[model samples]
Structures are given as structure tokens and as C-alpha cells.
Target: MFKYLKNDLPASIVVFFVALPLCLGIALASGAPLFSGLIAGIVGGIVVGALSGSQIGVSGPAAGLAAIVLTAIGALGSYENFLVAVVLGGVIQVIFGVLKAGVIGYYFPSSVIKGMLTGIGIIIILKQIPHFFGYDADPEGDFAFTQVDGENTFSEILNSFKQISLGSTLVAVIGLAILILWEKVLSKKAKIFQLIQGPLVAVVFGIIFYIMFGSTDTFAIKTENLVSVPIPEDASSFLAQFSFPNFEVITRGDVLLTAFTIALVASLETLLCVEATDKLDPQKRVTPTNRELFAQGTGNIISGMIGGLPITQVIVRSSANIQSGGKTKMSAIIHGFFLLISVILIPRLLNKIPLSVLASILLLVGYKLAKPSTFKAMYAAGWKQFVPFIVTIVGIVMTDLLVGIGLGLGVGIVVILYKSYQNSHFLHIEDKSNGVHKIKMTLAEEVTFFNKGAILKELDSLPKDTHLTLDVRKTRYLDNDILEILDDFREKAKQRQIHITLLSERGEVENPDSYIEFFRLRPKTA
Candidate 1:
């Protein structure tokens, strides 16, 4: 993992920038001490990153879990007791990993996975718009359309235009221009440009710009619009920030229930991030999901013991890492160390960097994820994939991450069911004489209730003078529902003056026997 330091170090800086505001924002949203988010960030990066089998996935506090964390803390009576639940949650997650529950990530359709990435990309772009304009009210990590601050995504963006910060707007535009030039031109021209990422350059430029413009009336960004890492007044205050979990609370029934909830939710969320990261990986490497869960569990355990929020693999940070050219887990590991060292030593320096510059970095990442070419490519892949992909993007945009994913999955399942219903038979129609037709219906290898509607519709459309043949020789399984439909259709055929013949593995019958007995379907074979 350390072998990719050249790429990893630069990428880590980008992720560190992305993770910083999110760490604080999620902690703030969860009603926890602001420093706890930093603690989680450190543990997620160092502990989880070191242990994970994923090449590009980065772990940290998740906005999706904020509500749960908030309620759990209040329900548990104290933050220390809440930490006990977190530790127990980590233990439960470890058991889930041991049971190989990570396999569930594999079951997500590829379309849904692509949709997730695209949706997240769109979200990043939307969320960063306000920050890009130097709007400081909404937190950096709130991805939901309806923010915790009670403003919708688009409205916040509209409001940003009214409260524009002059220095921030200028820095953002210049920072974006530099990033675009560095990536699109300089990087291709020289290897040095690739090693020194655009984001790193943009951030340094932002810092200098902040310093240079402070005395000028037309420039100088505000303290609220800059990166804020909590600064401890003294060494003793810094030491007091870490609060140990109360292990005695582990025996409480409510604590155990909350632990199960966190384990379940955190495990599911981590699995999703793992899947998204694997898809986003340029090399198309498959991460070991179980190892990922184990690493997350370990991270959470450490985080809780040290006054941090519970941790999970986060797609935003992971995607930021990937988009910034991270090639291995080393980027994630280094970013965690960056978080640790930054808080301890360079909190004031970090506080000088403008959020608008970081917003510019993420805007490019967002554009890359939801590029127009990606949309066209997905559209060309056929509706089965395209529909779900589009739906996922829309769903994620309209709601939050998991709900959007769930919506896309729902659409994907409908597509599967529709396809399954239409694929159970081949129908051949031929006009043999005046007002007479010969029709052949060949059953598929596996026929079930899903095929009942298609078969019945075809059978009902046969003309009075038609001679129909039902071929079941290739059919291995037939649902009772289809058999009943066939039985009803045969009686209707008699009334319509239609001639019917049945052919099966057993023998030929001129519609003289029970449809069920004649078909002789064994569902087990299917």
C-alpha cells in the first residue's frame, strides 16, 4: 500500500480537505462535540484504512447516521453511555463480517451501482454551489435535499447569490480555473503535474490569496467561510477533549438495542460505499467486502473509546480520494494522519484555507462522475440498465443517498419482473387459408406465474378459424397459474370453433387431458 506514495500523498491532501468539513458537520448534526468528528476521521482513516482490503474506499463519519446517533445519545441518557452502544455496535458488525454478510453488496444490480455514483456526483455539485459562492450557513457535509438547517438544496443555492462573499467568489473562480488548467493541460504535458495534483495547488493558492487580500476592501474571505478545525487554547484543554466510553452501560437493554441498530445501519451503509467505490475504481478491482466490514467495525470500536462518532466507509470521501488520483489504501491512511496532525499542530493554518477553493476541487470531481458522456453511455446500454440508472440519479437528487438508492433498486426490480414476464414463450402465426390461421406457441425452458399474463393474452387473441398448437417439450417448469389459464383457454377455444393441440415430453394430446397432468412440470428443475 505504501508503494503508491507518489500518487497517495497528493490524493490524501484532497481527501483530507473533503473529509475535514464533513467530519465537523456530521458531528455537529449528530449533536455531539465537534472534536468527536475529528476523532472519528482519524480512526476511520488510520485504523480502518490500514486494515481494509479496499483500494480506494475511505472510512469516516456518515451523514446518514446522524439522526440515529442523535436519538441514541438522547435515549441513552449520556454521551458516555452512547459510546458504550457504539463499541457494542462495532462488536456486532464484526460478527456480521464473520458471517459473510458482505455478500449482499454483490446482489446490487450494476445499473443501480452506476446510478449511485452518478447521483452522488450530481449531489456534490449541487451541495458545493453555495459554498462556491461563499455561502456559509449550510454545513459542508449535508447531502440531503432537505438540510438539517431546514433549507432545501436549491433554495440555499439561490440564497447564496444574495449573500456572496467577494473574496471567496474571486478565489473560487481563480482556484477552479487553475484546477481545470492543471488537470486538462498541465497534467498531460508533464509527469510532475500528475504528482502534484490540481487540488493541492488550488488549496495553496487559496491560502496565499486569503493572506494577500486580508487588508484590501475588495478581497479577504471571512473566518466562517474558511476551514475551521477546533483550536485548543492549551495542552490541558486538548487532553480533556478525549472522553472514554462508560463500559458499565454495555449491560443496559436499551444500550444493546441501540448497538444493534447502529451495527445494522452502519454495516448496510458501509457495504453500499464499498460497492460504489469498487465501481469507481479505475482498475475495476473487487474489494473484499467482509474485510471492509471488519475494518469498519474495528474503526468504530476505537472511535467510540476515544470520544468519536461511530464510523463507516463514506462514499463522498472515497470518491474524492479516487477522483484526486488515489491508487491504493495509502491515500486513506495518510489522510487520517493528516487529520491527526492537522488538529494537533496546524489547526490555525488549516483555518486560513477558504471553503470556496475546496468547493472548486469537488465541483470538478462531481462533473467527472456525472459527465455527459456517462449519461449517453448509460442510455446506449439499453433501458434495463438506463432506466434504473436515471431513476437512481433522480432519486438521489430528490432525497438523500440511501433513499435514492432504494428508489433505483425498486425501479430495477420492476424492470426485471417485466422482462421475466415477457420471456416465457415464442409465438409463431401463419395464415394458411382464407380466414384460417395456424399458430404455434412454444413454451420457454422455465415458465412460471410471471408468464401467465403474456400467455393468456396471446391465447385470447386467436381467431375463430385458427388452429393452435401448444408446444411444451422445451418447458421444464410450469406454474399452476399458467396451467389453469391454459385449462380455461381450451374451454374458450371450443366455444370459438378453434382447434387446439398439446405437445409435451410425454406425448401428443388433442386437448383431451388435464393441462396440469399433461404438462408434468417439476419446479425444482427450474
Candidate 2:
């Protein structure tokens, strides 16, 4: 980890800049105190990063859980009460890790995972459009189908256009331009360009723009649009922000339900982020999923206990971490430290940063995730891969993340079953010396219940009076459904005057009188 300092340090700074606005935005969206999100980011980075087995995975407050957190808080009647559920959620995730349930991440098909990333990328871009224009009615944090403010995603975009702030819009445009030039032009010029990240450059320019515009009396742009970092004059003042959970609410049934919701969603999100991070790693290192779960769970437990929002392996921060040249876990750890130090030392300085600048950074991140090349590449792979990929993309775009994945998984399963049925057997007819037609049916390596229909159809369609050979040597296992098919075929063989030969591991049997009795007979001694 230390060996990656040169790369990781720079990457940590980039991730720090990317994470700051999101931390505040998500907290604002959840209706939680603004400081809670920062607390989660700090804990997610330092605590989770220290414990996690992943080299590239980064943890922080997640937008995916914003809806749940909002509802849970309202249902529980107090923010402190909601914290109890978060702690319990962490404990439950630890249990999941102990049970080795993290393998669930592996079951997701590659197409669906890619589709998920692309969908999230598109959603991020759409959600940030309002913030870029300085429209702040909805929480900058929510990314779900329905927002805390009761507006749908499209409605928010339409509303943004109507209430756009000219000053904020101008700043956003300039910030975006700077980021683009830094990435496409400046970053390629020399070694220094490669060393400094585009986000840092945009952020610096953003502060300058804010100061220049802030002094003007004619500008309609409000200073509130800039990042608002809580300024604590002393240690006690800073500690005043901390809030503890009301453990008295622990016995409530609603509290338990909320805990389960957080645990399930947070665990799933963390697993997906881990998988995505592994894919992004230049070295292609595999993370220990169970360990990741344990780390996230521990981080959440600590974060929730101290007034922080729940933490998970967030893809936005992780993606930014990777794109900025983060090489190891150290980058993640250092970013958390940066979060901690920034809030304590120079929060006013942080407040000078503009949301539009951060929006510009996120726009770049979002574009990278849903690039046109991604779609073209998926299409080039063929329809089998592209269909589910597109389905997932559309589903996520129209609905939310989990729902879209469910739809994609349903389609993916159908594709798998269809392929299985198609490859279940080999059917051919041979004419023998005596003009007898020999029909051969070779079963697949493992015949399951899914293959029942295909095998039955092939057996029933065999020409009458033909000599049939059923080969089971290559088959390692036969499901009961296929076994029953063989039994029925044996019964019909005699009536159709068909000579049936059953071939097994032992040897060939000229006539299998009863399918059940044929299996009962032992092999003859050599």
C-alpha cells in the first residue's frame, strides 16, 4: 500500500473532491443533518478501508439508500431512533459475511452487471443536471424513482429548466469546459499534467469563479448555492454535531424492519461496488467479498453510532478513485483522513467551493460510465449479450437500480434456459445393412428437469419401427424427469415394434424390458 503513495495520494485528493458534495447532497436528500453525510464519508474511508480486503473499493454514503433512510427516519419518528436500525443493519451484514453469503455477487451475469453500471452512470448524469443549473428543491442526494421531494426524475429536469439560476449556469458551463480541457487537452501535455487530476483543477477554478461573482451586487446568484461546510470554532463546538441513537426504540417492530432493509440494500450495494472495482483495477485483483461485507458492516456500525449516515461501497467514489489513478487501499484510507481533516480544520475554505464545480466533475464521471463506446461494444458482442444488457439499461432508466436488475436477471435466466434446452441432446438417424433405420439419442453431460420437454419430444417423434439406441455413457447424471421419459419410451417401444438398445457405463443391453428393472440388473462378470 505504501509503495502506491505517489499514485494513491493524488487519487485520494481527487476522490476527496468528488466525495465532498455527494456526502452533503445525500444527507440533505435524506433530511438528515448535513454533517451526518460527512461523518459517514469519513468513517467509510478510514474504518472500512482499513478493514476491507479490496485493493480498489471505496466506501461512503450511498444515494441508493437515501429513500430508505428518509422513510425509515420518518417511520421511526426521530433521527436517533433511525440510527438504531443502522447499527443493527451493520450487525446483520456481519452475520451474512460469517455465513459466506457474499458469493451472491458472483451469480449476477456479466451483461447485467455492465448494464447496471451503465444505468447508474446515466442516472447520475440526469440527477446532477438540476444541481448543475443551481436548482435545489429536491435533495441533491436522491437517485431513486421517487424523490423525497415527491417529484419524479423527469419532472425534476423539467423544473430545473424553468428555475435555472443564470450565475450558477454560467459557472457550471465554465467549470465543465475547464474539466474537459484538463482531461482532453492539458492532461496530455506533459508529466505535470498527468500528475495533477482534472477535478482538482476544476475545483480551484470554481473557487476563483465563486469569489469573482460573489462580490458583484447585480448577480442574482445566491451565495447559498456554494458548498456549505459547518464551521466549528472549537473542539466542543465540533463535538456538538454528534448525535447518538435512541436505543429505547430498539424493541419496536418497525425499527427491526428498517434494520433489515438497510442491511439487505447496503450489503447488496457493497458487493456490487466490490465487483465493479475489481473490474476497474489495472491489475485485476479479486477482492474477498465476505471480508468486504464485514468491513462495510463495521464501518456502518461505527458511523451510525456517531450520527453518520450508513456507509456502503459506493461506485461513484470508487469509479472516481480508479479514474484518478488510485492504485491501492491506501488511497481510500487517505481520502477518509482528508474528509476528517477538512471538516475540522478549514470547513470555511471548503464552503467556498461551488456545487456547479462538483457537478462538472460528476458529469465527467457519469459520461465515463455511460459512454457511447460501451453501448457499441455491448452490441458488437451479439444479441444474446446485448438483449439483456439493453433490457437492464432501459429498465434502470425507466425505473430504479434494483428493479432494473431484477428485470435483467429474469431475461438472463430465460436466455440461459433456452440455451440449455437447445443443447440438451444430439439427434440423428442411420440406415443399417438390413435397411433398418437406427435412431440414436445422446443425452447431454447433465440432464436436468429443464431438458425434459426436449428429450420427450425427440423420443416421441422417432420414426415408428426404427431401431433406437439410447446413449447414457457421456451423461454423468439424469434427473428424475428424464428417467420417467425413458420409462415411458420403454413401454411404447414394444407396441411400436421398435428395438431399443440402452447403453450405460457398464455396457450395452440389447433390450431393456422395464426401465426400472434394467437399472436394477448388475453388470455381468468379465
Candidate 3:
């Protein structure tokens, strides 16, 4: 893990900066104590990173789970009670891993997965825009269209325009400039630049800018526009941040239901992230999905025990780590340590960092994920891949992560069914001989119910005095419904004066009396 210390160390710093605001913002979005998000981030980074098979994936409190956590907390009557649910959720996730439920991630279409990454990228860019101008009404982690602040995504953006902070905008502009320069020009030119990282410089610049102009009326960034880490004056106050689970309420039906919900959702999100992160990885390494779930479950268990929000493998931080050239899990572990140490030693210094600067960093990350080139590439993949991809982006931007994925998956399934329907068979009209139309219909390898419509249409349209050659030689699996359809077509053949010849691995049959019996007697294997 430490082999790539030079790369991982800098990447860890970048991830640390990226994760800090997100931890606070997600906790705020979830309506839990802000410190809880940091706890989850710490546990997720250290615990999950150590245990997981993934090299680049980062785990933390997720924006996708904010609404769920918020509602669960209210439904369970208290945050402490909700912690019990979280603990239960972790146990359920472990069971899921043991049951090998991670295979569910494999079922999603590649188009949908691509769409998910792209959609999230677009959302990040859009969400950060408001914060870029120092309008911090919505928490940075809230990706849903409807916000906890009673403003939808678009409305919040509109509101941001009305309340723009000049000072923050200026700092954001300079910070972004520094990032672009460092990444595009400086980093490539010098090893020192790569080791230092552009994000760190931008953040440092933001802090210095804040200190310089803090008292200026027009140029000063507002306290609300800055990172708001809870400052503890002493050890007792720091320890007071931790909240324990109300384990006595663990037996409640609501607690169990919430736990199951969190486990199922968190597991799903983690698996999806695993798939997406693997795709993004330049090294093309595949993480073990079952092991990932187990790691996440363990991390959640630890996090909940200390009053953390529900955790999942978060794409944003993971993507940041990858973009920053992190080569191993050490980056994630080190970032967790940074979080642990910073909160204890320099919470006040952290609070001085501007949100706009972080927003600028995320802006770049978003652009990389949702690059215009990606759009062209997706479109070039053709409509089967493109439709679902676009739908997913739209759904995610308009709603949330799971809903967007659901929409994309639904579209993907339809595309599969359509493709299956179209490709189920090949029909060729051979030249007529002896004034009789000779047609050859070749069934696909696997003929299921989806092909019924296409096959039935072709059969019904056959002309009178036709010689129909039904080829099933290459077919490996034939559904009973398709066999029944062929059987029903026999009557039409008789009425149309069509001669039927069945060709298969078995000897050819002329005008078979019972299609079903013929197939049943000569089993598919034979």
C-alpha cells in the first residue's frame, strides 16, 4: 500500500479536501449532526479501505442516502434509535455478502453504468455552481433535485444568482485558475507540482484570501460561505460529538425495516460504484463485489457505533482519488487519517477554507466525468446504448441516483427485449420454384416469449402454396410458448396449402403432425 507513497500521499491530500466538506454537507443534508458525517468518512476511509478489495474506491457518507437517513431518523424518533437501525443494516449487509448477493451488480447494462457516471458528473457540476458563487443554501452532498432547504435544484441555482457573494466568486475564479494552471501546465512540467497537488494549493490560496479580505465589506467572504467544521475547545467537547446507538430499540419493527432498507440500498450503491470505479480505473482492476459488501458492512457497523451516517462507496471521492493519481488504498486510508487528525487539531483552520474553492475542484472533476467527448462517444455507440444513457442522465439530474438508474435499467431491458424480438429468427424468401414460394425461417439459438410477436407475424404473412422450411438446427434453447406458436401455425399452413419441413439436429420431418410432441420426443440435447 505504501509503495506508491509519492503518488498516494498527494492524492490523499486531494481526497481529504474533497471529503471534508462532503462529510459535513451530507450529514447536514441527512439532518444528522455534522460530526456524524466525518465519523462515517473516517470509518469508511480507514475501515472499508483496509478491508475492501478495491484499490481506488473510496467509502463515506453518501449523498444518495441523505434523504433516506433523514426520513429514517424522523421515523425512528431519534438519531440514537436510527443508529441502532444503522448497526442492524450493517449486519444485514454482511448476510447479503455471505449470500453472494453482489452478483446483482453484474445484471446492469453497460450503457446504464456509463450513464450513471455521466449523470453524477453532470449533477456535481450543476450542484457546485451555486456554491462556486458562495451561495451555500443547499448542502454540497445533496444530489437530489428536491433539497432539504425547500428549494429544488434549479430554484436553488436561481436563488444563488440573487445572493451571490462577490468575494467568494473572486476567490473561486482565482482558485479555479490555479487548479487549471497546475493541472494543465504546471503538474506536467514538474514533479514537485504533482507531489503538492493543485487542489491543495487552491485550498491554501482560498484560506489566505479569506484571511486577507475577512474584514472588507465588499470583498470579504461571508462565514456562511466557508466550511463550517464544528470547533471543540477542549477534549471533553470533542468527545461529546460521538453518539451511541439505542440498542434497546433494536427489536422494533420500524428499526428492522429501516435497517433492511439501508443495507439493501447501501449494498446496491456500493456495487454500482464498484462497477463504475473499475471502468474509470486506468489500471482496469476488478474489485471483488462480495468482499466489497463485507467491507462496507463492517465499516457501517463501526461508523454507526460511533454516531456516523450510513456509509457507501462514494463515487465522487473515489473519482477524485483516481483523478489525482492515487495508485493504492493507502490514499484512502491516509485521507481518513487526515480527517481524524484535522478535526482534532485544526478545526478552526478548516472552518476558514472557502466552499467556493472546493466547488472549483469538484467543477473540474465533474467536467472530466461529463466531458463533451463522452457525450459524442455515447451517441456514437448507437441508440440502444444512447437512449438509456441519456435517460439516466436526465433522471439523475431531475430526480436522484437510484431513480435514474431504475429508469435507465427499465429502458435497457426494453432495448434487450426489442433486440431479442428482432433477432429471434432470420427469414429468407427463396426464389419460387414450380410456382410455389419457397421460404426459409431460421430460429435463433434461444427463442423465448419475446420473439412470439415477430415469429407469429412472419408466419401469419406467409402466402398460400408456400413451402416453409423451419430451421432449428443451431437453436440450443426453445421456449414452450414458441413451440406452441409453431404448433398453432400448423393449422394456418394447412389452410394455406403450405408444405412444412422441420429441420433440426434430429432428422427432418415433413409436415409434422404435432410440433410440441415432435420437439418433446426429440429432446433439445439430442
Candidate 4:
């Protein structure tokens, strides 16, 4: 881990900048204290990173759980009660890992996985647009369809723009320009730029820009739009930010429901992040899913204990880590340390950075995830892959992440069934001597009810005066529906003057009394 310090250090700084806004934004979206997000980020990075078996995965407060957290807080009647659920949710996840349930992640089709990553990328880009323009009405990085403020995503952006802070916008543009130049041009210089990451440079510029414009009376950019780091004059004041869960609420029915909701959502988000991070990994190392679950669960427990929001493996920070050249788990670990140290020592300095600048950094991360190449590649894979991929995208866009994935999975299953049905039986025709056409039908190993349609279609397509050979040598089991179809086909073949031959272990039957009787013969040897 230490060998790649040159690369990992710079990447950690970039990931740190990317994670800052998201931590605060997710907290705001969750209806939790803004500091809770930072707490989660810190714990996710340090604790989860230390325990996780993934080389590239990064953990933090997730946007996917914002709705659940918000709802849980209201339903439980207190944020403190919800913290109890968050901790319990972590414990449940650990149990799930111990039970080895992580193997379920392997069952998702490759096309669906790609679709998920691409869909999320698109969401990030669309969701961050308002923030990039210095809009803060819905927080800096909320990705849900409906925000905590009860405004729709697009509407919030419009409203935010009407009250746009020129200072923040100007800083954002400069910060974005610096980031672009650093990546496209400056990084190529091979010395200064490579050592100092673009995000770090952008953050520095943001602070400078804020300081320069902050004192201008005519600028009219409110300090509320800037980074709101809690300033603690002493240790006791700093400790005030930490809130413990109300143990009295632990036995409540609402608390249990909230716990289940958090567990389910956080586990899913962590799985998604693990998959996405693996894809982004340049080395393409596969993460241990069960271990990842355990790590995330531990992180959530620690975070909740410290008045933090529930944690999960977050894609935005992980992607930034990869794009910025993170090479090991050290980068993730160091980023968490930065979060901890900065909040403690340099919060006043951190407070000088504008939210719009951080938004610009995330905008780039979002664009990379939702690049046009992703769509083009999915389309090139053909409709069987593309259809589900597009369905998932549209579903996620129209609704929410989980609902969209469910829709995509449903479509994917249908596609699988259609393919299976079409390939369930094979048909071939040969011209034989004496003007007789020999038709051969080979059934698949296992034929279910879905195979009925294909069998019927093939039998109906046979021409008159054809000699049909039905081969069941490889078939292990045939559905009753298929047997009935064969019986009907036999009667039709007789009417069309088609000669039918059935091959089974019992013997070859030139003319069978019934399909059921024909299939009652001894099973064929492999």
C-alpha cells in the first residue's frame, strides 16, 4: 500500500474534495444534521477502509438511503431514535455477511450490471447540474427524485438559479477551468501538476476566490451558500456535535421497521458500489462481497455511535479515487484521516471554500460515469443486452434507483425466458430419396411449459408428405403441455400424409397410439 504513495496520496486528495460536498449533501437530504454526513465519511473511510477486502472500494454516506433515513426520522419521531435503527441495521448487515448472502451479487447479469453503472452515472450528471451552476436549494449532491425540501429536482434547480450567488458561480467556473486544465494540460507537465491533484488545486482556488469576494458588499453572496464547517472554540464545544441514540426507543415497532429499511437499502447500495468500483479499477480486481458487507456494517455501527449517518460503499468517491490514480486501500484510509483532521483543525479554512467549486469537481466525476461511450457500447451489444439496459436507464430516470433496477431485472428475466423458449428445440429438414423429405426434431435436455409455443410452431411449419423423426435421446424431462402438443401433431401429420417416427429407449415407433404412451418407454442412456 505504501509503495504507491506518490499515486495514492494525490488520488486521496481528489477523492477527499469529491467526498466533502456529498457528505454534507447526503446529510441534508436525510434530514439529519449536516455534521452526521461528515462523521459517516470519516468512519467509512478510516474504519471500513481498514477492514474491507476490496482494493479499490470507498465508503461514505450514500444518496440512495436519503429517502429511507428521512422517512425513518419522521416515523420514529426523533433523529436519535433513527440512530438506533442505523446501528441495528449495521448489526443485521454483519449477520447477512456471516451467513454468506453476498453470493447473490454474482447472480446479476453482466448486461444489467453495466446498465446499472451507466444509469447511475447518468443520474449523477443530471443531479449535479444544478449544483454546478451554484444552486443550493436541494443541497449540493442530493440524487433522489423528491428532495427533503419537498421540491422536485428540476423545479429546485430553477428556483435556485433565480437566487443564484454570483460569487459562488464565478468561483465554480474558475475551479472547473482549473480542474480541466490540470487534467488535460497541466498534469502532462510531469512535475508540479502531477504532484498536486486537480481537485486540491481547485479547492485552494475556491478558498482564495471566496476570500477575495467574501468581503465585497456588492457581491451579495450569502455565507450560507459556502461550506458551513462547524467552528468549535474548544474540545467541549466540538463534542457537542455528537448525538447518541435514545435507547428507550429501541423496543418501538417503528424503530424495528426503520432498522429493516436501513439494512435493506444500505446493503443494496454497498453491493452496487462494490460492483461499480470493481469496474472502475484499472487492475480489475474482484472484491470480496461478503467482506465488503461486513466492513460496511462495521463502519455504519461506528458512524451511528458517533452521531453519523449510516454508511455505504459510495460510487462517486470511489470513482474519483480511481480517476485520480488511487492504487491501494491506503488512499481511502488517508482520505478519511483528512476528513477527521480537517474538521478538527482547519474547519475555518474549509469554511472558506465555496460549494459550487466542489460541485464542479463532482460534475466531472458524474460526466465520466455517464459518458456517451457507455450508451454506445451498450447499444453495440445488440437488443438482447441493450433492451434491458435501456429499460433500466429509463426506469431509474423516471423513478428511483431500486425501482428502476427491479424493472430492468424483470425485463431481463423475460428476455432470458424468450431466448430459452426459442432454443428449447431444434429442427432440421433433409431431402431423401423417392421424393420424401426427412424432418428431424431434437428436443432440449429439459422442456418446460414455456417450450410449448416453440414446439407447436415447429410442428405446424412442417410440410405435407414429410417423414418426421422425433428424437428424445437427450431429453431428461418433458412437460405434459409439450406431450399434448405432440399428440395433436400426430393426428395432424396423419391428415397431411406425414409419416412420424418416434425414437426412445423402448424402441422406434413408426406410428404411436398416444404421445404419453410413447414417452413411457425406458429412459435413454447418456
Judged by lDDT, which candidate is best?
3
Question: What are the per-residue Cα lDDT tens digits for candidate 4 across 303-349?
Answer: 88879999988887888899999999999999999999999999999
Best by TM-score: 3
**Candidate 1 least-lDDT 10 residues:** 517-526
* lDDT at 477, model 3: 82
Q: For each candidate, what is the lDDT?
A: 0.89, 0.86, 0.93, 0.84
Q: Identify the superior model by TM-score, candidate 2 or candidate 3.
A: 3
Candidate 1 on 354-450: residue-level lDDT in tens?
Answer: 9999899889888888899998999999999999999999998998778888999999999988998889889898667777899998999888888
Predicted structure 2: lDDT:
0.86
Across 1-526, the per-residue lDDT of candidate 2 in tens digits comes to: 7997888988899999988988998898888999999999999999999999988888999988887888888989999999999999999999999999899999988999899889888988988898799886666667776765678888999999998887777878888998788878987888687778777887888778777875575544576678877888899989999999999989899999999999999999888778877877889999999999999899999999999999999888998888888889999999999999999988988988878778878888889899999999999998879999999988988887778888998999999898889889997777765767798888788889999888888878776778998887787667777777888888887888888888888889887666656554544421
lDDT tens digits by residue: candidate 3, 73-153 = 999999999999999999989988888888999999999999999999999999999999989988889888987657898
Candidate 2 regions with alpha-carbon error over 4 angstroms: 215-220, 432-436, 514-526
- Please provide TM-scores, in order, for all candidate models, with all chains considered together: 0.92, 0.94, 0.98, 0.91
Worst 10 residues of 3 by lDDT: 517-526
Question: What is the lDDT for 33 in model 3?
Answer: 99
> Which candidate model has the greater lDDT, 1 or 3?
3
Judging by lDDT, tell me the better candidate of 2 and 3.
3
User: Model 3 scores what on Cα lDDT?
Assistant: 0.93
Candidate 2 — which pairs collide? none
